[model samples]
Target: MRVTVLGTGAMGAGVAQSLLREGHEVTVWNRSPERAAPLGGHGATVATDAATAVERAEVVLLTLFDTDAVVDVLEQAAGDAPTDAVWVQCSTVGVEGTETVVQLAEKYGITLVEAMMLGTKAPAEQGKLTMLAAGPAEVLERIDPVLRAIGAKTVRAGARVGDGTALKLAANAWIASITAATGQSLAVARALGIDPALFLQAIDGTASDSAYAHTKGESMLAGEYSAQFALDGLRKDIGLITDSARATGVSTTLLDALGRVYADASAAGHGSDDIAAVGTAFTKD
Candidate 1:
């Protein structure tokens, strides 16, 4: 498979490397061209421009920061990619943006596959991402190798543009809620003079314990929120979930509250830090 990957940030760059490892010819393009350079060591062809990257590729993956970036890059690549080339959108643009991007696909006459990845940097590098995909079966069939190389498992959410993004929003809302809950539990333990380690021992192997709680809780206790996933990105996902929930009449009570907590963390200058730094929100002013 010949693949063109746009947006070579941590996640995108990792994904491009995964495709190259699978022995697919990969072309990578980023707004900042320097970010795409590191992939060259792995035999990736660095494109001078986005359009040049898409020109000869059978598959194009979009891992940009948001809907607008995806739109801008796709508009630049639209005319160059073949009509039958499957354009897999792996970014998390919420419901409204999903609709607009679907229109953009029609405008460009490319097969659009809404495939949202469920893991961050590490998983992308390891090729363990769960692909929550939605598109025509014919389209997916044409690009199965590309999706399989990027994700360990490919789940077909449904055959619509917004279906996969909707699932991603709900999943991220739960992630935000649980991540906040994990931090609060750690804070409560500290207030009571209980070692957070002891608290984990109490919940260990119980139904109340989850791998996320354990992993992120350890990071919180150690005061290490390195950017596996940045706080600002989580804030963006939270806001996207809240916006979608409101438009669909789903109560935003929990989602909005978590959004504020992440907002506070961002305001406190931890936006570049990992979301595990959410623990800081509880202890700081």
Candidate 2:
């Protein structure tokens, strides 16, 4: 497949690498040209500009920072984009932003797929991501190989444009809540003069235990917060979830409170750190 990817950040670069490994014709562009540099050695065409990148591909993948970036890049590329091209938007652009992307797709006569990547750097690089996909069946079938190349499993959330983003919100909220609880759990364990590992041991055989608990708990213990999924993106996800809930008159009491913790962590020095660094929020408090 002839593929163009915009925004070669951690996730984007991983996706492009995996696609190239699968022998796809890959073209990539990034706001910071250096991020896309290593991909050039991996058989990808490093595009000079966003529009130049889009002109030659049958599939366009976006993994940008936010909806605004996604919109801005697509607009820049729209002038040269193929009208019948399929755009698999792999960014988690929130509920409202998903709708906006859909409108843009309609306006430009392009097939749009709302694709939500449900893992971080390692999973992305290893092609072990769980993909939440929502879009037309025909377009999905057209790009199933590319989807398979990037994910361990691909689940179709729905046929509507924004359904994948909604599923992404649910998954992200679950992850944030777990990380927050883990922070509190370890903090309480330590303050009470109990080894944090004892808490890990206690939960080890229980249903309440999770892989995330172990992963983030170890990060807490080692004080290693190198980003797999950065705290900033988690903060954004929290805000996105709360806003979406409020839009439908749903209660976001807990999520709203969690949002503040993540926001404060972002305001502190942990924005670029791992999402597990939220453990610092509880420990410091």
Candidate 3:
């Protein structure tokens, strides 16, 4: 497959490398060119500008920051892409953003596939992401090779363009809740004069145990806040989640509290750190 990946942030870079490993001819571009430089050594062709990136591409992958970035980049690059190119939108842009992307695809006469990926750096690097996809059957089939290179599984959300984004928001709500709950548990343990590691040990093989809890908890315990996924990225997703929840008549009580905790973490200069930094909000005064 001749593929072009735009916005080579952490996840985008991972996706590009995964494609290269599968022997796909991959072209990559990023707003900050340095971020895309590393992939050149991994067999990806680094494009100097967005317009040149997709000139020879059969598939265009988007892993940009949010709605505006997606819109901005595609506006510049989509015109230059091959007319029949299949576009895989891998950003976590919410329901409204997906609508805008759909409109953009329509304007260009391109096939759009909404593929919201699940998992963070490790999964993306290891080619094990779960892809939530929505698109026409023929288009999905056309891009199956590209999807398989970067995803362990492809879950069809629905035929509607925004269905994948909707499903992604719902999944992220659970992730935000569980991550915040883990931070709260670890914080309470330390404040009560108990070793937080012991709290992890107590739940270690119990029905209450979760792999995600231990992963985020260990990072919090060691204060290793380096990002596998940045705190600000999760904060953005939470905002999208709450907006969707409110529009659907769902209660925003838990999401509102989670939002505040994460907002404090971001405000305190941990926005670029991993989400385990949320533990700081609960632990610090």
- Please give the lDDT score at residue 52 for candidate 3: 99
| Two-way lDDT contest, 2 vs 3, winner | 3
Per residue, candidate 1 scores C-alpha lDDT tens digits across 73-141 of 988989998777889999988988888899998987878988898888888988888899998888888
Question: Please, what is the whole-model Cα lDDT of each candidate in the order they appear?
Answer: 0.88, 0.89, 0.92
Q: What is the lDDT of residue 201 in candidate 3?
A: 95
lDDT by residue for model 3 (73-189), tens: 989988898888998999998988888999998898888988899989878988999999998888999999999999999999998889899899989898888888899999999
Kindly list the per-residue Cα lDDT of model 2 for residues 149-231, writing each as its tens digit: 88999999999888899899999999999988988899999999989878888899798889899999889888899999999
Question: Where is the poorest 10-residue window by lDDT in model 2?
Answer: 276-285
Model 1, backbone clash pairs (residues 3+ apart or across chains), number:
0
Lowest-sum lDDT 10-residue window in model 1 = 276-285
The stretch of ten residues in a row with the least summed lDDT in candidate 3 is: 276-285
User: Candidate 1: misplaced stretches above 4 Å?
Assistant: none
Model 1 residue 25 CA deviation (Å) reads: 0.7
Model 1 has an lDDT value of 0.88
Name the best candidate (by lDDT): 3
Counting clashing residue pairs in each candidate, in order, gives 0, 0, 0
